[model samples]
Target: MSKNTLINILFLGSILFIMKLTIFPQESLGIGSDSGGINLVPFRTSGYIFLHETFIKFIINILGNIILFLPFGLFLTMRFKKINRLWKCIVFGSIFSISIEIVQLSIPNRWTDVDDVILNTLGTAIGYAIYKIIDKKKMYLQED
Candidate 1:
């Protein structure tokens, strides 16, 4: 009913979504690319390994990485007026991605990738852009 209540709900939803993306089983989902050459195989692998994995899988992986952080940027900017800056959301996304990668290093069967960080940052930027656009539209409409 209140703005704070909505913010809290969004915050919880964001955290749950993030956990779903980052948490993986100790056993390998075997999503790795064995064919090699240019695939979305984590950090060191070549893009050739793309064939080992399906095109749809690759697309989902990339898009999933992006969408995973979208709410983070949106909800963060919405909840914290002070952190509503575009740069701040970008930084937060970067840090969050890096943190996931680092934590993955300690986890079994998880490989950290630079691509995730880049994709996540892009997602955060996009979310912030959406927020800004909507925010501007709201202000414009309110001018009446």
Candidate 2:
């Protein structure tokens, strides 16, 4: 990524981080009434599916979590190209999630849950994975 791209990503990431901190404050903190509890089932089975409820909720939840920190991953990746490795991604994601959890714990309306950290890390990994796939594809195309 170029300097301009790095700057853009940082600027956008900051904006997104702030927006996330405010807009879905409750959900982000894993405290909202609608923030549903964590299900032990790895994947929802057919029996668990409700007629009115779409499986898309699972997808939406996963995607929303992944998307929430995408800008963070994108910006970090762009800014520190040298450390653009999986371990670094994991560390950054972990730290970010930890920070959020800590903040949530201190906030009045927020409820910090270890589960949220796990979910957030999973989300960060997903975002980083997406970024890697796209970045690699772009590089391959350019090489070709």
lDDT winner among the candidates? 1
Per-residue lDDT over 33-133 for candidate 2, one digit per residue giving the tens place of the 0 to 100 score: 34323333433422243334577755555555566766666666666677578778778877877776666554555545554456666766666777788
RMSD of each: 4.3, 5.4
Q: Candidate 2 at residue 73, lDDT?
A: 66
Against the true structure, what is each candidate's TM-score? 0.80, 0.63
Candidate 1 runs further than 4 Å off: 26-52
lDDT of 1 by residue, 92-132 (tens): 88998888778766665565777778888888888888889
What does the lDDT come to for candidate 2?
A: 0.61
Report lDDT (CA) for all predictions: 0.73, 0.61
